[model samples]
Target: MPRRSYDHYCAVSRALDVVGDRWSLLVVRELCSGPRRYSDLFADLPGISTDMLAARLKDLERDGILTRRKVGPRAGTAVYELTADGAALRPVLDSLSTWGTSQLGERRATDAVRAHWFALPLGRAIAQRIPAGTATVHIGDSAFHYVITEAGITHHDGPAATPDLELRFDLSTATEVATGVRSLADAIERTAPQVSAP
Candidate 1:
């Protein structure tokens, strides 16, 4: 068998060349929800410094993976969004998110940790994990019913008994696990979350 070289493969190399950096993949993930300006992007990614984000955006724009559009006449009011080619990566991003969540869910060991889950992709993914039927979820003091239907999981706000599965964790832990920062295994081993049997 011949040795595979990244440099020799145009297709593989081209994909990497476009999203070769560490933050580039995260940039793609952030844009998966929708388009946003640089400020919004930066706000979501607190750990990323301004200069580094600027560089990554520039590189992505140069590689045609992202498009920078002026929002208005005001200077520095530009929104960076994924191009058509970049939009094609949605499935890949979704798969990554799903895999990360599964791993985290499996890793959560104890039954006492609290998780503050963010909306959008993570919340949607979490909704899919419940057994198909009528149920409710109690995260901390909050509670929402998980009504399984042909469409998907729908939340109903009403007075309900203790949920079948109770997840507890702080805001940072929840976001970290949801965002793939802390694997479920790591959270279980570290934070010790308890997932009740349904």
Candidate 2:
């Protein structure tokens, strides 16, 4: 089938018109996390000036991608929300994040901080298997240990002394498997994951 062409025949050009410059997608990402007051959004995204943030938001609103609502009961109170169209970009963002993580060669403290926390599928897997124990997960160069007790979940850097199970994987495979982009059964069959029972 022939590709459906835009009027300009330049998808990148059209997308740029909506989210062209810096901070536009980031603002959309922030809104995707949840509804936020303008101040809160500004605070969460570091290094974005108040004026630039406002301008980007205005542009998105103009493009019908975002909508600003008067949140509180009183006057002068407002919050930003992603429209249905805007919210549809979440999968794109998640794929980008997963891809970005896979491409990083030298892991940094921030990457550790980010991937150090479990993705939802991994979290659910760990939570189900070890209701009252700790486990260390090593995926590529990233490592993090989680302690699950009667209290709650506690995270630590690096491997645990002794874990009930050690789940080892390459970063990309692990991410794809965790996010359901790739099947876990397929990974198991393909030996993409090295699972150790302790």
Q: lDDT of all predictions, in order shown?
A: 0.60, 0.68
In model 2, what is the error at residue 84, expressed in angstroms? 0.9
Q: Mind giving the per-residue lDDT tens digits that candidate 2 earns over 85-123?
A: 887765566566556555655545554333432343454
Question: Model 1 reaches what TM-score against the true structure?
Answer: 0.52
* 31 Cα displacement, candidate 2 (Å): 0.9
lDDT of 1 by residue, 6-93 (tens): 6756885767766867788888766654567998788767578999999888887877778988877676588887888787776566
Q: Once model 1 is optimally superposed onto the true structure by TM-score, how far is the C-alpha of residue 147 displaced, in angstroms? A: 18
Q: Which 10 residues in a row give candidate 2 its minimum summed lDDT? A: 111-120
lDDT of model number 1 = 0.60
- Where model 2 places Cα greater than 4 Å from the true spot, the runs are 1-8, 105-198
